[model samples]
Target: MALYDHLGAHPEDRDGVAGTRFAVWAPNAESVSVICDGNGWNPGSDELWGSSSGVWEGFIPGFGPGDRYKYAIRSRSGELLEKSDPFAFYAQHPPHTASVCWNLSGHRWEDAAWIDHRRDTDWLKAPVSVYEVHLGSWKRPKDGRRYFSYAELAEALCNHCEQYGFTHLELMPITEFPFDGSWGYQATGYFAPTSRFGTPDDFMAFVDVCHQRGIGVIIDWVPAHFPTDAHSLARFDGTCLYEHADPRQGYHPDWNTLIFNYGRDEVRRFLTASARFWIEKYHIDGLRVDAVASMLYLDYSRKAGEWVPNKYGGRENLEAIDFLKELNVELHRDFPGVLTIAEESTSWGGVSHPTYNGGLGFSLKWDMGWMNDTLRYFEREPLYRSYHQGELTFRSVYQFSENYMLPLSHDEVVHGKGSLLNKMPGDVWQKFANLRLLYAHQWLNPGKKLLFMGCELAQWTEWNHDAQLDWALEGQPYHDGVRRFLGDLNRLYKTHAALHATDCDPKGYVWISGDDAARSVLAFMRRTADHSRNLLCAFNFTPVPRPNYHLGVPVAGYYKEVLNSDADIYEGGNVGNQGGVYSEEIPSHGHKHSVEISLPPLGAVVFDALTGQAIPPRPAKAIEAKALPSNDSKRPR
Candidate 1:
């Protein structure tokens, strides 16, 4: 059970008296009292008795549910402080910081079937494509600036997820935060679901609806640091109870937040309990831990002379590392199907490996390098891309270092960074083409996929926390084409075994032609664990079609063109190998057989080789053998 159940306000019957039991931890306080609506918010009216362990307990008759409360403590140093309960399950909608007492039991959950399936499922081999969303901005009430309630968001969000064939929905933090601009990153209530949308039960119903629709929910959890709001956990008991006393260690430079004292037993327990509470209470499928790189290092954003080194004279924060390992161990041990993903940007070794093998024990880590390099490559003009071919191929060196999730997340489109569609360097037509190619590349690559909400719609503007997405663009032909392409890509990714089976294994990916830089083309083959099914992916980076482009394949039968980013349905030039091509016995790129293809301009084509089966060709026009001139005579064959 979580600490919230033991501490804070809970409904209880003591000696036949129906009342609420209040327990709080204020180790350094001289006196503690529950200041609530029943007591007219007076500190001395309902005083609590203290124990040796620093906990104070009391029972207030008739103060059970729907009461607003705060803990008033007189510090040992003769100072008084009023703070919200850190273990609060629901808080007053912010701008008012009182913790609300509410009963968390008796809400029925209908996700038993989903829970059972999750436990027996091996997620490593599963097709995990997450659609990252900011609930407030995903959609809003049409009448005005008022937000959509959780119940409304549940049906709308899940419907969109099902339409796009997304396997999971990764929510950008919905925890309680005072400032709307912070986008819930500076969370005040760790255990409480933000009341900005609705009540705690409303949020629970939102999650329930997702599970009913077969979409897993992943919340972005921020345990890295907290906002220094006065009413929050900043200086409870008029002392640095949750944070460190020293500014050099506790204060965060970048975000102006306070770091938690992970070394302290109570603090560790509080953080871990918060993590467990969400999984146990809300039935969340996974937790994508935010700013993990900041937690792992003591000098993350500080100068060498300004930071304090660890006891071992190293930059690594040992306590935080231990806390992470323990958190992962406990969560995985207790919740069999729950996932813990890290947004770690550094080259940290073994981030997703097992804890028993001297690793951090996370299920997955975000592939920041892949995201950066791929974006950098796509942002360059096609004429200059040949010189930067390494940008596209560099991931092969460290792709299998961790169980990676390739995320084109919201971070990339905020704070002056343009949206994904606007980041491409090209004319209007080529821009949409480049965006389609980017999505195809992400899906065809060997990793799990995560796309921020508006990228699929090809929205031109950057993400704004206060404003909703450009829903009007969905009706535009070009914008609708991108959305259609994404939906098809997602469906193909989920159904194809070769695309997701060995996403984390090296044996699943093989390079067919990675050095065709003159035309800025890339070709790779994705295979199943037993090599039973194979997918040959080819990309033409420039807006120049290449006909009679022979791609190497392991099999000799017909290879079906499963997906084409340049198809007319996707608002492209429609250049491609008609439907399927027969492989010839000409050895190319060290393969026994090869197929000639019409590679589209700034497009991606995926060919599925149905091995050991007779594949009848679909009706289509025959592709003419008109090969484009290559700078390298020794190009693949």
Candidate 2:
């Protein structure tokens, strides 16, 4: 039998009879049988004969698509085990473990336009603001339904994403998993969409609708390990078929799951094929591989002498690296515009580099350091923020390292970490202001963006996988303000070529004032490749307003205040320049011309240099900066 032949159940016609061909690799099984509803669950009736390839094959003359089935194998130790098909196209809804036979060739796709747009699009140079979501909780059905089918989620989720100006939706793992409590990380069905959200075709419809709306769908993929459930790939045929036999190499201490035997060719193929199946069958725009650090290092979460080193006596998992490279190379070769992002936390070099250049071959890597530093900084009180200003500046030391995506992922909000809004150490008004300022900094800074779902709504509660977000709060002024601010931020990011065009290039960034910790102020300039446009971004982290803050500008004239996080519309104090500020002959911050402007309390303001036109000089009196109340006691007019 060929390598593909024995992997899972496949449809076939047996001598003029409509049926299905069942095959499985049970090298250590004393006997293997295909037991299904069609066979009256009689294991002996459909006993499969073995071949030299170690695969047991049996043809069922009447079983076709949509039939429920499972493999009953007697382990070499004479223990009977019932397991779902590893390559199952569908599965029984959770609380039921049977695999459902599904034909994949039925869905009608209407996303050719989206496909063409993606093929020609350069994601690296494009704006990629992602809204990370867990499907089960993003939104539940209103009519007393526990979950929305994929089609239902598509309409609702897609609209919300587009409305908020997110370019992509990064869904948490939809790969079939048993417990919703694990949040889909512990996957049992690699090829099947969770039956919790309708069928495989329903998922296809979801992707199709997202693509049609110019939204890229990115799914979380878990290749690091699998749960040790009896009916899963674990201990298949009573042997370590997919995982390593040794506990040191196979077991994950933290997750208590089984690590894949990446050194095995069949295991590599199985994982690689699983990755390919999602993209080829569902037309997903990208895959964000989760827990990559766990897969890359041999000593991850392990004590000394508890882990096995690679053949070269190194801690790096060489086989996993090889498999990753192969997976990336093949995906890139097949899908021209698709992206592969790694949720790798360690300081691994060359993660987003090319495989041909001896790299792991990812398109982007999450900047865990930045996220940690940022959250840590924002969580501090405004008075103590100056002491930890280094947290804000240290990331720029290696900001351009490997095309970073600054992620405030779900991992940050769950398990006592607190929600993004609650993490802000302030009174209610100040908390919302701090969150708004944080988001402003996130977008204005150099890097791509990824914010978890409820962050935009400024949810007070941490994510609960079992419940929907606080939608009733959306009508409130404060939450609506945060939502509006997010929409504006996203639009600003996408609209400005300077903000996104050179996010990965060093030339696009200029540090205007990164050393103003005492004042809790920072300013930077984002430039385009051609220098045709430049946006000056300034942040006042403290609650005190600066009346005469002088910032240098590359060009002189009128600098338009393009975006202000402190604007009243976003429920801020409405403190800012009248509309735009005028630059004078005074030189500051190493620039030829500079502007002295009023700074809002705990706000971020962006100034766009007015260029390509003659400047009308402002009256001398107009250049004078006015003083405002230093304390945040001032209210919006």
List model 1 lDDT by residue over 5-37, tens digit each. 998899889899999999999988999998998
Off by over 4 Å in 1: 617-637
Model 2 TM-score is: 0.95
- TM-score per candidate, in order? 0.96, 0.95
Candidate 2 has an lDDT of: 0.90
Cα lDDT tens digits, model 2, 1-637, are: 4333446777777678888888887788999998888778887779988988788887888788889999999987889999998888899998799998877888999999999999998888899999998998988868647788888889998889888999999999999999888899999999999989899999999999999888999999999999999899999988999999999999998988999999999889888888888888889999999999999999999999999888899999999999999999999998999999999999999999999888899999999999989999999999999998899999888999788898989999999888999999889989999999999988988888999989999999999888998888888888889999999999999999999998898889988898889999999999998877889999999999998899987778788888999999999999899878888888889989999888899999998888646454565665667897687657565
C-alpha lDDT of residue 549 in model 1: 94
TM-score of 1: 0.96
Error of 1 at 306 (Å): 1.5
Q: Which is the leading candidate under TM-score?
A: 1
